[model samples]
Target: TQLLEQSPQFLSIQEGENLTVYCNSSSVFSSLQWYRQEPGEGPVLLVTVVTGGEVKKLKRLTFQFGDARKDSSLHITAAQPGDTGLYLCAGRDTGGFKTIFGAGTRLFVKA
Candidate 1:
């Protein structure tokens, strides 16, 4: 099993604001993923970073993988009430099927 640590466990922002959440770990992963979740439902896959120094964008959201393949970050621009939810990061083991998740960042956006 891999371990990922997420920062700023909670965030509250006003509409149109911007925010970034970070995930860090000492172990390298074959691939890492980011997810967004709403109340009473399963999380939705946002992006997956598989290579070192790779970056991906989903609309106003940006995701980056560390050069060492051991860390990642997610940035969201122009926050909205609809964007409010729990953001999570997971790392897949390089040699097995194990996947580990951070506790998650709960975001609250006020309109």
Candidate 2:
């Protein structure tokens, strides 16, 4: 079984719609990162949340880390066609050196 299985694994929406993606885990990480990726290209870092209970916003994107540092969520406002891509959440365990990723969320924003 996968350690991280994000919710609503696949999403298809219309342009200008808003959606939220979630990452839940029983493990706690020292830091967590969010990324957006396209076909054949590397993931593009959106933001990293380290401090528990921290919230960060970039343009229409909003990211949050759980107060226990065991979970995270991403919310996108006014979704655009450009937002169509794969969204991923990854983090390293409190003691582990390697980073593990939650099953990616595939978003399809239609015009």
TM-score of each predicted structure versus truth: 0.96, 0.95
Q: Which window of ten consecutive residues has the lowest lDDT sum in model 1?
A: 1-10
Supply the TM-score for candidate 2: 0.95
In order, what lDDT does every prediction score? 0.94, 0.91
Candidate 1 local lDDT, residue 82? 91
**Which residues of candidate 2, in runs, are more than 4 Å off?**
none
Model 1 misplaced regions, further than 4 Å: none
The sequence of per-residue lDDT tens digits that candidate 1 reaches over residues 16-73 is 9999999999999999999999999999999999999999999999999999999999
Q: Provide the global lDDT of candidate 2 against the true structure.
A: 0.91
Model 2 per-residue lDDT tens digits across residues 1-111: 226668889999999999999998888889899988999999989999999999999999999999999889999999999999999999878875878898899999999
- Please tell me which predicted candidate would have the highest lDDT against the true structure: 1
